[model samples]
Target: MFFDILPRVGLKPKDYILKFILPASVISLLLLILGITYFSGYTRLVVLFLPLLLMGSAIGYPYIELDSQRQKINERLHIFITKFGVLSITDLDRKELMHLLATEKEELGQLATESHKIFVLIKRWNQSLAESCRFLANRSPSSQFGDFLDRMAYSIDSGQELKEFLHGEQDIVMEDYGEFYKRAIYTLDTFKEMYVSAVTSVSFFVTFAIIAPFLLPYDFVTMVTVALLGFVLIEVLLVYAIKSRLPYDRLWHTGEKPTKIDLKLKKWLIISVIGTVLFTLFLLWGKFIGEIPQIMKIPYQIIFALGMSPLAIGGYFAQREENLVIRKEFNFPDFLRSLGDSVSAKGGGMTDSLEYLSSNDFGPLTKDLEGLYKRVSIRVNSQKAWRYFGYDTCSYMIQLFSEMFERCTFLGGNAGVAAHMIGKNFRKIINLRKAKYQSVSQFSGIMYGLAGGMALTLYASAGVANMVNGLYTSLDIPDTMISIVNIITPEDFSLIAYLIYGVLVIYSIVSGYLIKLMDGGHYQVSLMHFVIMLWVASIVGYIAEVMTGSLLGTSLPI
Candidate 1:
């Protein structure tokens, strides 16, 4: 039904503001105004709900569009560079090679679309290759690709060999790619610093907001709502800002068989589920039925901490999987170097070279290497077999390197040369990744500390509010002073505690995901970090509650 209406309003996927955000804003504003006018005393409820509607409209769809665009450009650009480099060195003719490049069915995102346009202009409209390339260059979305096209057009006009130009251009592209890789790492380092500063500052603000009810005559619920919204907004925007700078490539691979690790994770998962359920039941019974003793009563913060334990356990397993993959990748260049040495010495093909190399230890990759040797030795569709070999490795750099090697070898080119090039490029990338991870390691401590601080401050603020409210009600104040008192009762403090607790839950998750994304180049590996951060929030909240109660017992009238 929404889709049916979307077209009527000139909405499309690319026009994010018109397609999603503008309509969301219009509807939210209308609903907000209606609630304010029709309902007498629910302004706080309406205001509290507005953040989700407004923030999603303003930031959500735009970020989605940007992420989509980044993926398309990255994939397309990589494919073009890899393919152009390999085909240039092959014996395929200029026109035949250009035809293959232009008409290849492999989707290089916008690159494919533009290349197809160039092909159509030349073959259908009878435009020369130079003319078609010139036209395409003028309209290309990526400026770097445009410059490449413009150079290609010039090369054609001057009667220079397209192969030579492409071969030379690969060196330039690789250099640019190295710089690009470095810039992304630098951006991540900068983002980490910004994140620490932003989260710490927001933590202090939330603390102040929580304490405001004691001193200021404002709606306590409204103040909590604003604090929650403010924290959520900063975290969400920070995540959005970094999405564009992260790598977008992913590897495809053969199915992975379950191992001992899977079995261990499964057992822990069951235990976590049962433990969480039991904890929740205990909390409910204490809250609703009053069956538990006062000393045994579990706070909501403690309950939240216990519930997220399973995710942490599961995340550890995920981190292990990533670690194994990285270990395999770390030795990949050595494997490539060995392959090149074997091929150069024995004058054998990739299959024979791999059969000998499989006997050597490639660290974590030894098992996969044996599998690849069996497949290729059996002559079971070499290209498909090598592709799965790349996929099984599950490293983006390996995928790219393997594709280049596969292309060159399939073209009956020098396997030794291809291996050397792949090894060199892979080594450079690996070193950059190590440096990036090392640079970002210091920020992890900052995150853990800041997350705890935020949680503690929030919990302490709630404790103070409750303590002050209790004293205000019990005291024999003047009638005039009683009218001026702005007290948050114990019941109201419970609501605020739960609300702020929920906000902290989200902030911790987002921050953990951000840390993982910056370090691992993906967020799927963030579960461990997320779980740890949640535990930090939970523990800090409890500690703050205990300390606040003890301190106030001496300082305030009981």
Candidate 2:
């Protein structure tokens, strides 16, 4: 029954139940009790107006969180695919990875609990794909890792062939995975840096979003619409500016890390700060440097605020610098090339040579790697340990290296050559990335522009709506203009009035998906699109108030 009303009402039955029906019903009952009071009616004030506003906000917050995560993921996917060459490892692979991950959960759990293998497997299986391995590896090989590899090894051609192939493919697989890892790392670098920038952007709104709205108690729809629109537009341009300021992608597999990020962050910070100071000084300098406003300067103030806001956010990110979480992930390919050499050397156990990397000099990943190394050194096995390392490290570099180490230890023949080949593959992957970035950067501006600019339009239109209210008074229009203004509207100033809402609605929906479709995936953007549209509607409505007064020539009433 509710489904039938969904399209016409622009809401689902369930939503309408919460948004329109439930509260409206409650308010309707209250209104029936209160009756229309003299002077400002309490029904409109306490019953109708406030409840709808609160309902809208409650429904909207979840949508925001959902969209925020969706946006983050889509963006991550875009950078990941573009910066690294295409690589597919789906949640579908979870089953396969899980089987390997739980190779010996029972044995490990027995030291802790005897009757829990199935439960442990299920628990580990449900964890994030990367996390599943982290959980297992942090626990160490015990017997689980070798058991998983033994399972992986068995899957090769046939059981005997699987064993033989595992021995042979160890170096080759490690090298290939290493190459894949490099491309992954290159992409992650940009993502991590941008993520920090994005977080800072979120922070700028953090204070405003929580407190200012409540204290001001101004027309919410008007301000929120403007804020959202401006946010979108500024973000679009700023993202463009940030993208522009970012150096071109360069393939660097074995050389020192990209120094440009450090240099450019500093450079842009200095430039933005200097520009802000000069502009502030110029404004405060008054007629000394420019035209002194003897008239309305509010518009100029608005423009200045809009223009300066993004830079403050940009400057925030330029200050935080995080080195690679997994530097060895990059170095692993090169190390694998050496491993192939070590394997061919015909000397001691392949296990001993591989454990050398888990050292202190590197960052967080090195510690994890050292733990994996420690497992093999102490227990003479690393299957579960390797899997742990593979999944836990978020960086593609670490996962690949962990996988490679497992393979080489099993297939000791080309450990050294495998290492060399892995490095070479990283070089190839890096080259491909350079090509991808150049092609992709072409649209970076367009996406950001569309996103940011459209958002700003949402903001500006509300103010325009507000401005419209005075037109009637200016024109000396009659009180009957609401009925007589058929040329401009059917119900009210309805023509261009609802036009902005339509635009903001479509813009929110399309942008949410466009961000996902063009780049990649988002968890659930639909809900967010709805929230954004609702917020925008409120903004445009506020503008409508001003516009209403202007159009009708209504004087400001006490």
Candidate 3:
């Protein structure tokens, strides 16, 4: 398996052995010897595993790289194939189409690299397209991509029209891609269940640790620290698991040129940072100084909420832009179809077609469409103008399909057909995104509910324990019974409170990022959820403390 993957990853067996395996083996041997000579007991055991782990990683590196490449290709295969079909409808022949695709490194990613390799084989080696496709098919890391290549080779040899073959392949590939996408979502759902179960278990453990001091001789802080560490590890694993399974559906275009929205987002981000720093400083000063106002001496929960409040401004703006992008994406298919029809009707005059469509309303996309028309009409760089339009909309899909539309029309392809095909596939992806969004929305609600429940349970347990300790302190019990009870003290409760707060912070941060992973949104957009979840947990904790204190007929220190 290792040798097979090495070739797929472009490494010869001898070279891989000489460059990686030999060096790794020597290092592993030396490490194992050193560990045995220098370490003792459990430390020796841990060090002993280090060499084995290192050797395992060295041996598996090629397979890992191969899988990474396979995933990258498979993730973007659907979109690449769709774009390929659109471009195949144009006047560019097979080689030209391949070269053009090879140039689109940003949009196609690894697929572009593969396309460039194929182009090199055909251009440099004078191989026929069919032979080149077949040659590459054997070595391709992705089974799906390899299968497509195999089929393309047969179609080429059979003298089928490239456009028609791609049109058929598009449907087949998309259907497969849909199944692949659904499988990813199913994995996400399974991970969500796993996450809930794991977190609940950790919460129970934490509660047990908080109350354990009354009976067990274990160090309370140490026990809680272990639980918190375990909780963090679980969250990290879940984040990684979900991220690995998520589809490569990006919302924002990754262009070098900054859009107006990008600039505004940056401005708001700066404001948020400045405000957070200032607010945090003020809170820290109030905390350290004895002259803090009585009203400002609220619980840490409120303090955290206020400190994070400034971030919401930037988050809200980013979220609004994200929504605006979705809205524009929804209207993009119609815009493309209309533009295609116009271009065809006007005999391939892109500027004239844009002028005609500029008068039409495309919902949130109308203004950007007008801007595109104006730029192209004035003979400004059409590519830059369309790029700006895409950036203005902040939709990655629009950038891709619009670029395809512009390129195909410029090549004198059947504009109406290209538009229809692009629009149809674009709508399919949008529908899939809708399904994903619905799933994430439900998951969001669950996360919020979980956060509240966790906070309440944790704080309520702390409150009840503290109240019990207080009650025991106020009792006039005999010395013998008092010694046997091993009651928790005020200082212990304070430590537990701090530990619980730490847990809440960790949970809030992890859960917020988890939501972002499921939805495939920008991390900055996740700040809103983080702030909201943090506030929910904090407020719930505060309420739990107050309610528990009242129910226990005690005035707990606020």
Top TM-score hit: 3
What candidate 1 gets wrong by more than 4 Å, as runs, is 1-79, 94-107, 127-129, 156-160, 249-300, 344-348, 520-524, 554-558
All models: lDDT? 0.70, 0.41, 0.84
> For candidate 3, lDDT tens digit of each residue in 379-485?
85777788778777888889888888777766767889999988988898899888889988888888888899999988987887777778778888897776567
Query: Which regions in candidate 3 have their CA more than 4 angstroms from the true location?
Result: 283-297, 464-489, 551-558
Q: Compute each candidate's TM-score over C-alphas.
A: 0.78, 0.35, 0.92
Put down candidate 2 lDDT per residue, 1-558, tens digits, no spaces: 425424322355577568656776676556644544432565446554655565565545444433333233222221222111111111223244334323423212221221123235546555433333334433322233323334443453243432244344444443443443354445544653553355346434522432243345443345444544554565455445444323222221211232344455556656665775676566545534455774234333232333243344333443232224224345555555554566557564555655654443444456555666676677655676666555444334345444544554453324454454446555554444444444344443343344344434433443343334434334765777544431211233343334434444444444434332322212132223333333444444444444545655441221
Could you tell me the lDDT of residue 264 within candidate 1? 57
TM-score computed on alpha carbons, candidate 2: 0.35
Q: Output the number of the lDDT-best candidate.
A: 3
What's the lDDT of the predicted structure labeled candidate 1? 0.70
Q: What's model 1's lDDT at 456? A: 81
* lDDT computed for candidate 3: 0.84
Question: Candidate 1: lDDT of 240?
Answer: 87
lDDT for each residue of candidate 1 in 1-558, tens digit (9 for 90 to 100):
434333322345457557566777787887777667666556758664875667675665444544454445553465577676666666765555667676654435556656677778877898887898898776554566778889989998999887677667766766766666676777777887788788778877877887776788878888888978998999999888887667643322323443344455566566666766776676667765866676246666666676566666666665676677778888998998788777767775677888888998889899879978898888869787776677667665666577667777777666676676667666766776687678656766777787788888777777777777778878888888865788765566767877877877897788778777666643444666777777888888777877888988621221
Model 2: worst 10 consecutive residues (lDDT sum)? 81-90
